[model samples]
Target: MRTAGLALAGFLAAAPAWAEFTTGDALVIGNARYGETVTAFGPDAVQAVARALRLRGQEVEQLANGGAVAMQQALDGFVAAIDEGETPLIVVLSGQFASVDGGPVLRPAGRETSKAAGLSLAAVLEVLAQSPRRAFLVLGEAGEATALEALEIPEGVTVIRGPAAKVAEFAAREMAQPALPLEKSADWYGLALSGHASDGLAVLTHTEVRPPSEAEQAAARDRIALLDETAWQRAVESGAFQAYLDSYPQGLHAEAALQMRDGAPAISPAKAEASLALDATARREIQRSLTQLGHRTGGIDGIFGPGTRGAITAWQRQSGTDPTGYLDAAQVARLAKEAAQSPAPSAPRPRRASNAVSAQEAATWNMARGERGLRAYLGQYPNGAFAARARVKLSNMQRGSGQ
Candidate 1:
């Protein structure tokens, strides 16, 4: 299948300094020098987009045929630069986008194929979603509308997928004029491309495009109400706010949740001192490191629950340190360093057994009746003496039930 081209354009028109796109960040990428199938107009499209963005008083980062590392670095820098909520982030990608596992993947210049050297659309969206600013993504010469449609874009983000034939033409026009407003540019491009029988132009925004279902809206409201409960007023921890945000990212109180997360007030001096002695974030990091090293802490939720403390103690014992549940800064650092050096633990493989069922297995054999019980028994002892019998019975039962 042929890879499609894409361009992501973000606009923060609500900013006070927005004088027809006087300030914003633009990343223009063109990957034409691919070892495999390459878009001939990719480089030209990138240059054109860069020129247009520059004319709009936007700081443009133009990369032509840059490989994966360079692209990642540029994207990271762009994301970091979007510190201010008012600043817009625009990304113009003029490269081959291959569909892999029902998702879009960007093919870099040096890669033989997108599967071997492509960036996932999910990763790109994650980077864009990090920015608090409202983003507008514009795709040029892109296909796979299904993949794009499947994306769960954040609340303020917008997407515009342009027609494949008109992508190069639009870029060329922008290069020549450079003063056209983004909306006008999109409109003109859409109009020109509408004549094509295979035209696939769409204007997508989270608000104007994808609306939440009634169930989803109700859940969001419930989460917002939970956040507004009086229990959180006295002790507004980062985790509490994070939980709320996780549940209702685009909720009515999303802005407030962000503020509380970013600017959480200091606790009392005594409380502060106590917390400093046992920093939750630090403890969570330690727990993660321990879990990665095969010492299960139940989970890494930042809460130093009994499971976490026990894990910490076990880790301390293994490291030849005093088995203190609490981890000091130095101890945490040491644990982190050790964990980094150790190989990542893999999932446990199922144990192989003989065909003969054991005494314990025989004891549970009577309980193994009906669909659920038989399935549970088979799961526990797949290689048991009655395994074949169980399978035949299960299959017959399933077939009889029309399952």
Candidate 2:
């Protein structure tokens, strides 16, 4: 079967041309001269897009058919333009991209020599990392790569990579029309995009920031006041103003609630989660619930990091909540309940007899692993020596989790 094209995860956004409204900087390097053996990449296409950017008044630093030294000089110019202003920075390199011993490098024109002959993409990526908001790196693969290696792209920066000619074409077309988003355009070309570049990224964007009109400000105040009043009424009915204040710091009756609690510090969302005093075991249970519910919390490890935060955000987005990427006491409870209603991620692994771990040790380990993993072991070895260890482990777990 024939395939369309291979895509790594993530997306990229090209900036709008801005000789007038915005100032956008671009670094475009096209290296087509590899050797007689390699296929020539799109030198003409990248230059076309560079010309398009320049036409829109963007500071364009382009190196056409450049060698390693020339490519390095182009990178310096790109950075200098960025330091001059805070604007959208677009970098495009179309040529023989390959995975070398050190890292991902673009083989410059007139280079069939050592790995050092190629320009390091890692350095360019580092520069892009700084201006992440408007930073994007469009890598167009010129020739067929013998080995496809994953490039380590940082957060906030977008990346769109595919066959050199097609991507360069896409970039040229999209840059010409700033209104066309990348997601919609890439879909037609079978390209994949990631990061903030998703949901159709466009070139030459000027985000006009103006204060909300009188009507808009009034509407917002009305909404917040209504929420505050409702919370206040509920607090009065339940005589739990302290709890109400903990949940809403800016409620209408917040000052009254504060007086009721003798001016206790309001519990922030972060503080509330910390108040759970969750141990590793409790954390794993939370992760399990999230994973089981198909949020994919990376792994069932206890610590909550970016993966867990992302999972939480995903869950919130699905549920139409605030999507704050943080969990409070109530949100945790809701997640637990929802996960119970949902099916498991996968079936339990069947026990296998192996010399590496004895049955008793396995039973104890299973006890350590959550989700009633101890049933098989307990049903068989009710009074084994390992059973005693498992019981002690459970007690430690309960204490650690503050349960």
Candidate 3:
């Protein structure tokens, strides 16, 4: 009974090893010459793939400027090199997508190469599908989406790419500013690469990740944190997002995650208006709105000047209410009503004491919030109504701070 059990366990252990193929080499084709035009973007992308794969212990055969004939030869060589019995096989291609009737073609080498022989994504996937070996296909430039859509990723093979525009733009930018030769710093575009690789063990690119560096990991972490749930699902489903959240659950996005789990309410656009203080932009917007309503709330510069408050008061008066000068929900409503009723009147001069009261209130509110540059705010609009209150709060803060 013990011998039989041991034999069964041994077979189970050997089963997975036999079921998968694991060869350690790579074929990087950046076929830029489609019947003889230099394709800089495709070649550049292929070089990037070659460098990345070489670092990962793969024997790399890089073919540049090869049109269709050259591409076929390389594919044949690749097949010959890998033992069908092994597990993982990686094939990366970067080139223009040629639409040939119904099928998509990867433009290959030579001036005379027919546009057709360049393998379609479907054709490539079909060839890869023959063996249960794990395969990785990267369609860098044109037809990326169409190819991904056309090819059914064999159960063991993985397919990864973004839209053609995104891939092309990224490849161009990466080539323009190639990472420092062989530098493993995190800034090597590792973050973006990690984001792309989140779905599975996949090709690394400048947009997906920096080559391999400390900053690369940091950038990757930050990028991962920023990924929305839908994007996260894509990565997780692909099986490539590394870095355990439990290891650094309280990392940069810790706050965002906590907020999400806490069921934080979605901030409405209307609420954004009320949350404003006397920031430059906020002041300008308020003044503009008030001026349009005929309240003439000061100059258009973002300072909440006395003119703005006076306008608020007039708006309040016109609407049958006491003018509190400061903008609030009620004030906005009154101003909107007056605007609807008649054409805007000329800008009015400030009322004595009313502007001062409003200023004081505004200052008090600022002090309550512990906003910096209160002195500057006061200096700009000294005659505000809440001057006394602002002064009191400022003194209290100074005292508490032991200043």
Comparison by TM-score, 1 against 2, better one: 2
Candidate of highest TM-score: 2
lDDT of 2 by residue, 96-171 (tens): 8677876788875653466667888788888888876567888777666543356778787887777876777777
Worst 10 residues of 2 by lDDT: 1-10
Which rank order by TM-score, best down to worst? 2, 1, 3
lDDT score for candidate 3 against the true structure: 0.45
After superposition on all CA atoms, what RMSD does each candidate show versus the true structure? 21.3, 24.6, 25.4
TM-score to true structure, per model = 0.38, 0.44, 0.34
Write the residue-wise lDDT of candidate 1 on 284-333 in tens digits. Answer: 67777887788776455454544555787898898888786666557767
Model 3: number of clashes?
45
lDDT of 3 by residue, 1-403 (tens): 0000001123447542211111244666665544424444454555565565544334455555454544565675465344334334556666666666547777654443465766666666665565443455655664343543444465655554544334434433432232222122222433122111223232332221213234324422322232222222222233212221221244333333334334457533222232332345655556666676666653555434345546767766776775555455655555556556656556553222322235555545444334255465555545453333335335434533446
In model 1, where do residues sit more than 4 Å from their true spots?
1-21, 114-116, 130-133, 142-149, 163-165, 171-184, 191-403
Clashing pairs in 2: 10-193, 10-194, 11-193, 11-194, 15-203, 15-204, 16-203, 16-204, 182-201
